[model samples]
Target: MTDVTLIFADLAGAAPLVMVLLGAAVFAMSRVSHDPRRMVRVLIAIGILLFVRLSFPLVIPLLLNDVIGAREVQVRVLWNALFYSVPNSIALGLLFWTIFDVGRARSAEEMTRA
Candidate 1:
């Protein structure tokens, strides 16, 4: 394989990290008996995010081979359209929403305690 292929193959190096993310999602999901809706959203959004990240290395082979396109611009457009721009946006939004939700809940609890 070329150096380019080797470099792209390194993208899969994060596969273990993705597994950790999935495990965390499953653990968080186990604690959500009180809110089925939130649980579903969290699972779906995190699943999508994890799968997208996990599959990034799978696309590198196509990218190196010019199956998608030869030009860098075409590759950028494809990456943005297919993976980086839309799906990640929604996934990250959902992640932030979860964080915000937890912060708000904590704030409310502290207010009540005070």
Candidate 2:
């Protein structure tokens, strides 16, 4: 098989694992907040991962074309799709969390004023 195909296959196989981790992180953040610091750290880590993963599929093929040779085209396309979809999904989740947190804090502040 071509190198690109191999790269695509590897990412496809690994995507589900990443999804599981992301899902677990989301669930943990939503359900457990006894320790806000711990949850924040987890969210930050996941955010960074999401950012990095988003770039990989798009950047890898362009940067590694020489090394990837025959596999470049297919792998690049696959990476583009995977990176765009997965990381964006996670990023959206994180954004939603931030919005919710902000709303909660604002409500609490208003309650305190009352």
Best by lDDT: 1
Steric collisions counted per model: 0, 2
Model 1, which residues run further than 4 Å from truth? 1-8, 60-67, 73-82, 101-114
Candidate 1 collision pairs:
none
RMSD of 1: 4.9
Runs in model 2 deviating more than 4 A are 1-4, 65-114
Every candidate's CA RMSD: 4.9, 9.6
lDDT of 2 by residue, 3-107 (tens): 677566766766875797689678758956554754675577566665565446546566556555435567767755775677666765765676566544545
User: Over all chains combined, what TM-score does candidate 1 have?
Assistant: 0.61
Write candidate 1's Cα lDDT for 1-114 as tens digits: 236566456656777878888897987689677556667778877887787776655665566556655457676667647655677789778877876786446456766765
Candidates in order have lDDT scores of 0.69, 0.63
Record all residue pairs in model 2 with backbone atoms less than 3 Å apart, i.e. clashing: 3-71, 4-71
